[model samples]
Target: MPERELTFAQAVREALAEEMRRDSHVCIFGEDVAEAGTPFKVLSGLVEEFGGDRVVDTPISEAGFTGVAVGAAMTGMRPVVDIMFGDFLTLTMDQMVNQAAKVHYMSGGHWKVPMVMRTTLGATRRSAAQHSQSLHAWFSHVPGLKVVLPSTPYDAKGLLKTAIRDENPVVFFEDKMMYKLKGPVPEEEYTIPLGVAEVKREGDDITIVATSSMVQVGLGAATLLEKEGISAEVIDPRTTWPLDDKTLIESAKKTSRVIVLDEGYGRYGVTAELAAVIAEGAFYDLDAPVKRMGAMHVPIPFSPPLEDVTVATEETVFEAARQLCGKT
Candidate 1:
């Protein structure tokens, strides 16, 4: 059978639709989600299939609906709240960090908050600073929350299903710029467990550990490195919180050099944590200090030129890896 292909948005919609059909408890809450299917239209036609009650359209209040979703999850419904923009995540931090994250722990494992928050990250849509930010690191820092960043259609669908079924709260981050990216997705049911890393490309020269959207950039950089007689391994830690440190450590051990990449800010970000993990695990077997590449430490710009420089690109990763391997 020919492998079926789906865009990232289609994969997300399929994941939600499948989960909703399989479990009545799974529902969505977001502005215009019921009728408009969100600005991205990832949820189009879902209300027709599941009805308005389950595919709820909320007011223009991120905090209000997020709080409601938390309560709903505590009561037994598996609520998937949608924050239209990732920058707006600041509005839902309290609910996510204090209430949802500590519920089971405070209750001594007596209560479970089976909730999921889906939001978009990445720039270049001219959405400006208020709408563009990759804030997954904040949620990952918390003890109980699971942070998922799916880079491709397959990972998006599979990771989402797993997040929806998880007993604890999960924050799913999607690259808004990649909703239309095409990739192969199987028609059969599948779920990718949180905290596991997948090596997109295997090599012996260096390891590039990338998260979320940076995975694609890392792969491109690997291709460039390969042409220069430099081998690069690319690993994607699909989820940030329950991170797969072992796989990352082993990759670093094999390659001896590593570069950590993400779309978030470089200072005290996911890249730092990943680099620390690699250093801690494979310190004895070393070639160079793990380099970190990420978004510039500033509010995302609306200008094409300014915004272009802020994000990590294939060329940037390639240069960083080449320099790390002493090729440049």
Candidate 2:
């Protein structure tokens, strides 16, 4: 079969469609899934094909629907619930953190909530505070939830497929800025297992570990660093909860310096988590303190320039890496 390229949004829709077709118990429920098909149109045309019973549309009550989905998952069906914005996940924490995440462990291995909570994270187009937040770290801090953030179209489809098929609750975060991003995805069915990191670019001076939208910025920084005769290695964890610490630590050890970038706040966020892991695991290998670049500790501003300054960008990644390499 011929391989076809697809946008990140298309890849997600394809994965959900294929999974629903393969498993009768697999159903999707979320606000606007039936008509608006989500703000990114990830569920576009799904209701028409799968019917309303399977591709359900819920009310604006995120907490209520989240609990309902958790109950459904524990009973028999596998429900993929969409919460629209990553920030809104806070509203459903009761069901997600207490119920869905801990059900399998609380049941002593007798039962599990094999649910996928789909959400979008990023600060593009000025979505503001309520809609623009990267809460992957929050979910990763919890014990039972599996967090996956895919940077490429291929990983997005594959990881999402894995999340839907896995025997645990998975929090799948897609960056809104990357929805229209294009890449080559397999024309056939495939799945990228969680907990594996991809080395997007290889270098020797320093390792840059990033997630979600920061991956693109990291790559761009690597390009600029190369021109300055500094070789920078870039690693994408792909999945946040089951982080590929081994790969990341080894990369940092090889380079002897590191820069961790994220789209979330710096304090107690994914960047901090990764920095702690590298510091604990590869303390001897580091020649200097690991640096982190992230959004400022403030709500995403509506002003484009202010939003640009607050969020992670190519310049931010580059300058941080420069400081780590003693060039700044």
Candidate 3:
């Protein structure tokens, strides 16, 4: 299969279009998703291709539309519900946590809520506190929900397709800052299996486990580490829930040093969870403490300078790696 360069948002749109074409049951609904094509224009022109019936533009009611999607999924429709902003997800907690997530388990496996809840995360676009957030950890803590945060265009397309086909409710998070980021994506059909992790770069000196946009930041840090003669391995846990612990544990065992990075708050966030998993599974492999880096606990500010300080950057990651390698 030949590969072509595509932005992260374009890859996501391709996945949605391809899945809708493959399955008559698949449909997408959200605020401004049809004619307006979303603020990012990811769904631009999709409504024209699929028609308004399949590509719906709903009222600005997160709870109402989310509930409708859940009900539709129960009746055999694969509905992709888009939450324009991660903060808006708070309004649909009942539909997401209680109903959609637990329907299959509550029904003794007789029913399934095969739905995808896609939302944008991260800070840096000056969207302010309401629109900028990395809340994957909140959903990951829920048992019945599958949490996925894809870092690259390839993973974004493949994982989203898999999420749409999944039998369980999937909370698919997209880093808002990565929308224009481009990468190679094959034209051929493909679906990356859920609960799997990918090793973006292999090394033996230390390991950097990152999520969403942090994966790119970690890779940049690894490049700097290389100049200092430090071989830093990079791992992206594509899905937060049912994380690919095997790959992470093996990498920790090989490197014996780990730095977990995320865009969520550092306190009790996804990085903390990854550190716990590594300590529990590979406690004997540790040469030093597992360092975790994430955004500061303050609300994301609208000011560019303050926002830059709040979120993790390549320099922050690079310094974390240096300190772990005893070079700082």
**Residue-level lDDT for 246 in candidate 3:** 95
Write down the TM-score for model 2: 0.98
Full-model lDDT for every candidate: 0.94, 0.91, 0.93
Minimal lDDT window, size 10, model 3: 319-328
lDDT string for model 2 (1-328, tens) is 5568999999999999999999999999899998789877888999999999998999899999999989899889999999899999999999999899888988899987989999989997687778898888889999999999999899999999999999889999999989999999978778999999999999999999989889999999999999878899999999888989999999989999999988988988899999999999899999999898878999988888888888777877788778778896
- Candidates ranked, most accurate by lDDT first: 1, 3, 2
Clash total of candidate 2: 0
Model 2 residue 212 lDDT score: 86
Candidate 3: global Cα-lDDT?
0.93
lDDT for residue 179 in candidate 2, whole number 0-100: 94
**Model 1 regions more than 4 Å off:** none
TM-score of each: 0.99, 0.98, 0.98
Ten contiguous residues with the weakest lDDT in model 2: 312-321
